[model samples]
Target: MVRARAAVAGARAAWIVSGPGARPTMLELEHEQLGGSARSDDARSTLELSRGIPLANVADGRRGVALARYESARAESASLARALTIEVRATLERVRVLERGRQVFDRLVALDAEVTAAARARVRDELITPLTARLVELDQLRVERRRATHAIALEEALVERIGWLGADAGAIVLASEAVEPESLTIAEDTIAARGREDAPAVLQARARIREREAAERLLAREQHGDAHVAIGAFLERRPSETATADDGGTRELGFRARVGVPLPWGTIDRMAVEQARSETGLAVQDERVVALAAATEARRAHRRLRLAWSQHTRDASRASQIDADLVRVREAYRDGRIGLDAYLAEKDRLTESRLEGLESELTYWEARAALERALGLSFEAIASGATR
Candidate 1:
């Protein structure tokens, strides 16, 4: 993103300094000193200054071509920025999901310890068989291993987030609560429409096509070449060689005017024009390809976002019910109404629900980010339900 912005700045500066309509006239100064000259009897010196103004730069339509190129650079920069934003958002969401998973696993590991201790006590009191106690211990070890895995995954995700957001992000605290799924009320047709005109990829391709078109026109105009007018004045001084000696030797002052008209018969000019025409045709084809791909991606993203949100909504509701069920199972196990195996099974169900919910939430957010990128819309705009 930083690099893209810097490129944009550089392009802007270049356009202002050297692009269309800048420094219309070229200026030059010349000076010469002669001593012991073959054609002159005395030493001589000359000074000349001239300005050549191009009269064909604007008339040839190269100015429009330069402007088109500048605009193309801007569009490319915008596309890069949008891609970066989408990537950053997806990475942040992934980190958040991993963190939540780690925390949930941590709590589960502690709960497993309590369950294992209780199972051992029950075995000592002869309330449960040794095999049951062994099973409980094995489940505790498994939970511990899963917790360790989550911890490692969380660390990796944090590092990834830091890579995207910079070192300072390492100190930033993420919210414990998960983000709710965004609503997908906008129609897929709207997204397809917007993507064709507003998506970064499509916009960039369109800009480049226009730039190439301008270049083609400019090249065609160049076949006639540019016209320039130059005017100069010069002063020359030398020792007088005439019969009569002058007060100040000899001096000559002269003015000159020149107009240049190219014959426009250069082979390079014809080749360049042909190349530009071929490139313009390629650019036109590229725009079509880009537009088609952009629209397809936009529709695909919209479909995925809708399905992910739906799945997340269902998972969220199921998770709430599982939470209530887990509370009852825990109470029943403590009250001796449920056996160790039954209690463990219920706990596993709750764990499955939590993990599945987390996965669904992550998927939903990822799809949302993808959709935002596809349509060239901001997160805020999507969240505000103004995707149209």
Candidate 2:
């Protein structure tokens, strides 16, 4: 099976996107502190700050802070551009990594196909030519042998879709005549390394987490207000509670007044900061754990492939021995070294041995394939790169 080839030379476009808008996160704390003063001044009109200036301007001030969070979201439009810049670039890197192996797979398919065809031709040239089916021969002698099997095909599975790659199925390659069935090899380390990183899914998840964090921090920051103390000298012409019987029955006095609170941040924003912190911790841990597991899986797959290769030579020889034994027994019996019952018994043994050897060979090949799949390396990338 083939994996999706990474585009290399004609690097279609960069996949990773990081840009200026990503800078906002850097200033999150500073903005959280300063943004309030700007909003308090600008939003006083909409927030009815003047109408409640005396008693409950507190609520109005909090509302002014809330508007800042909304503004933060508005500015986050920059992250989109940021994200695009990085995404396209990461994709191009991935493409380049894959293209190298694809070249090898292309040649592999051709060689394997040639050998397969040659095997078929050999049977036709040497075996089929001598076996002239004759009705008259059957009439002359009652020795009639029914062909037990039809096809001489050796490969258990058709080498269909040589470069067929699917989701990280990049490591496996088509078997060439020289590359023996079930053997695995790799060209690029980056493909495996990237696969180990599990970057795409991890990045996507991180994006959502970061967005939430920014928004959460905004939410928390709004809870508090600017740390300002009012130093106002209030000259009162009238007092609201009662009329002072000073001189004219109507009260008029000159008094200095100061009104202020430390800041609204503790009440309006700190809780949001705490929540964002917890969420960030969770996101980081999750990505770390997932990334580690993915890398371990890839590495394990790679190790298994290496082990499979170690056994390939021995398996091939064993399979060859079994084939030779089957051929020798079958010929001896057919040439009358044994009688009918003995011939039948020897033929049965040979068939079983041949079948077992084929199964063993197929098993080895399949194991090699599983190992390759783990490596996250693909031959198709090589071919595709060479094509471009």
User: What are the Cα lDDT values of the candidates?
Assistant: 0.72, 0.39
Give the range where candidate 2 is weakest over 10 consecutive residues by summed lDDT.
43-52
lDDT of 2 by residue, 1-388 (tens): 1123232211111122234431111100001111134322111110001111222334444455466445445434443443443333323333332232233223323333343343345446663232222321331122112111212121111212122233433344423321443323443354345544533334444555555566555555445443322222222122234545443222232323334444453643576677777887887777776566655655565555455445545555675565566456545544546543464455455444544444443444444434333332232432232211
Off by over 4 Å in 2: 1-269, 317-324, 339-388
Best by lDDT: 1
Model 1 per-residue lDDT tens digits across residues 137-206: 8988987887787788778877888888888986766453434534356677877777777788888888
Candidate with best TM-score: 1
Q: Give all candidate RMSDs, comma-separated.
A: 11.9, 20.3
